[model samples]
Target: MPILSRAALVEHLVRTRIAGDVATPRDNNLSHYRKLANGDRHYWLGLELGDRWTDEQDVLAVMAERCGVIDDPAHRTGQDTIDPELTVDGLERMAARLRKAAAGQERVLFATGHPGALIDVHSRVAAALRAQGCDIVRIPGGLVADEGYVVQFADVAVFERGASLWHTHSPEPMNAILDGLGEDGRPDLVIADHGWAGVLAQPVQDRVHGLRGVG
Candidate 1:
């Protein structure tokens, strides 16, 4: 289903509950402001039966975004702490963001930990997302540590790496990547699969409308 239509449904529901009428904003552009005020309609908590798929994180992130909720940590401030490892699932989610950024013609910025472990998953996901219209680029760091911290610093950094490089990979590089872009993508949307404290920050929380988990 389309995000706009889904957002429309959410808006209608919100207005009907409060005023017995659907406000249906003229803009037709559903944003975080509408979602945050109306109540989160997109996020849900629970793990899958097991780590069964290669790109489960990607699948879930997309589902969560479509549903209008951020995944994992319900709050926008970001995860309290990120994992020390990037599971195959984690890599997949980063790939999905890369794909989304690419499809929208946005310059994708990707980072991950245990590059060797995530490469296969990343490759598969990158290939799939690229096929769909996303341009992919692999940041130099293979398995980045302190991903949550670095991501918070970057204009748009995908968190797939673990916490090993956080201290070493200063926020400067992240800022540089964003600065190099020179221009933000139209209709910019930032999505994250992991990063507790990073995503919980004020602006990120404000911008993201929902989170949905997919099998």
Candidate 2:
């Protein structure tokens, strides 16, 4: 499939509900922003925000610039927009990074906290990277974290507990994978989302790896 141009992609996003007016409720967005403002790590998505985003309004402003969400503090709860421009900007950044990875034949790890919704996305990227001569790093088996064993399905890393695979936001599974990697190797890039993002908040013990968490 040919890649869409910026304009075309923006239109496609709104047409497909991937951007413009999204399905996530305004109240939900505000709630998460409030939590992040309150120093809730769960809402931080694995980032060390520090004192930078303690105010909800400040958070909203940044979101508006980067995510296209409504910036008005008075606009509380109603329809919110995900600016297609910002969304496309993010897509472009991800594409550029992937291109670099492919050119370098870098090792990449694919993981997702939202398996039901994003597994296919991760799998497709992993396949493309593999085809481009990148190493699709394998998750070590028999490792456990978040009360579950880390596992892989469809070329993407995930968690399996209770004899079944499950979705998670915990970074423990990812940390386990890194620990299991030991001195053998580490991925140059880890593409992850949701709670798996939190792992980045904790320093990687001097291991230099890129974490791409697409919201």
Candidate 3:
């Protein structure tokens, strides 16, 4: 069965504050875009944006197209809305990719930066892929990254700091895994969310961003 009918998925997303009722503020998003436009590598999340975008408005344009946010530069300090249909589309696309990987028994590496909200979701997907005979690639434990260690639990890699799985927007933990895998033993596909996903996975560009109340 489908994860949810499209209508049902949209309802659940709004109910759960995943798309509507989002938590980001307008200033934060504009600031991030400004920093990204100014060539701050941290916000690029591992993508080599280079000097291609020198204006924050231009950056906002790309983000607006990709994320379904309103594209008005004049609307300065409230929450921006996320397009629920776009959110549904993104999730369905992820489902399709998982189906393909399972069919091919592809070697897939799973990782998450938002552990508290998503670890169980990633772990459950990892488990299902393994059941389908796909290779769920494992990263060696305690690998060095971002003043912490890269750790694995329930078949998903996470950034470990102070002996706990920590929230992160850095892509270093994923980078560490790729380095360790080497060219010969690399995974055929990578499943990730947030910065790690943005840096190492093909679907990163489809990710959506939103603001809290500026609509």
Candidate 4:
């Protein structure tokens, strides 16, 4: 399949949002949209990379459609519930891809701009990497605000679970995370969330082995 232009992809996302057929924010957090909504139960879309994009758009538009509420009282339906799709198996596949791509490096660091207390998933990831001969590290002591930049300087650096910050058009945290790594002498690979990869394309190229997870 030919790669679609970024502009075309963005347009696709916009159309999907206007159609009210996109996934909700909570579902996006879970990383898959609903494949089918049957009354109260939602069948989740599998989280294949192909499922992540409609042309070039990441799952952002779907989130806006599902979560962004309008204040008009006329549109309010008290009984309505937003049901979105999600699958634990699919998220595991994504984590596995990250683990596989980051394999064989001297050190693998998972850095996130969010509070460290919220990232228990990293511990499981670290154990998995150890079993597979990879040295996985987390930014120490749960003090995430200041130490993320340092973590990204390792042989392989990754940002986990950054979707909202991406779609809302925020770049400062992402920049601080990358710039702190010293662009002059950067790491071998910079694995990031899709939003960071979109804006920091060149820095990634000049500093590391290019961005991972733009999909």
What lDDT would each prediction earn against the true structure?
Answer: 0.36, 0.81, 0.79, 0.38
Q: Which one wins by TM-score: 3 or 4? A: 3
The RMSD (Cα, Å) of candidate 4 is 14.4
TM-score of each: 0.29, 0.88, 0.86, 0.37
Candidates arranged by lDDT, highest first: 2, 3, 4, 1
Identify the candidate with maximal TM-score: 2
Error of 1 at 106 (Å): 5.9
- Please give the range of 10 consecutive residues that has the lowest summed lDDT in model 3: 206-215
Name the runs in model 1 displaced over 4 angstroms: 1-107, 113-116, 137-170, 184-215
Expressed as tens digits, the lDDT of each residue in 1-36 for candidate 4 is 686564554455456553224433333333232232
Model 2 C-alpha lDDT per residue in residues 1-215, reported as the tens digit of each score? 99788889999999998999999888889998999999987777656668989999888898898898988888877888899888888889999999998999988888888888898999999999999999998987898887778889988988888977787757678778878886557677878887665675456553243333312
Clashes of 4: 0
Residue 27, model 1: lDDT of 24
Best by lDDT: 2
Better of 2 and 3 by lDDT: 2
Output the worst ten-in-a-row residue range by lDDT, candidate 4: 39-48
Tens digit of per-residue lDDT, candidate 3, span 1-215: 55568999899988887886567877788999999898887788766666888899998898788776668998778887677888888888888888888899988888888888888998999899999999988886558999999988888898988879998878778878877776665787777877786665323343222111110
Q: Model 4: clashing residue pairs?
A: none
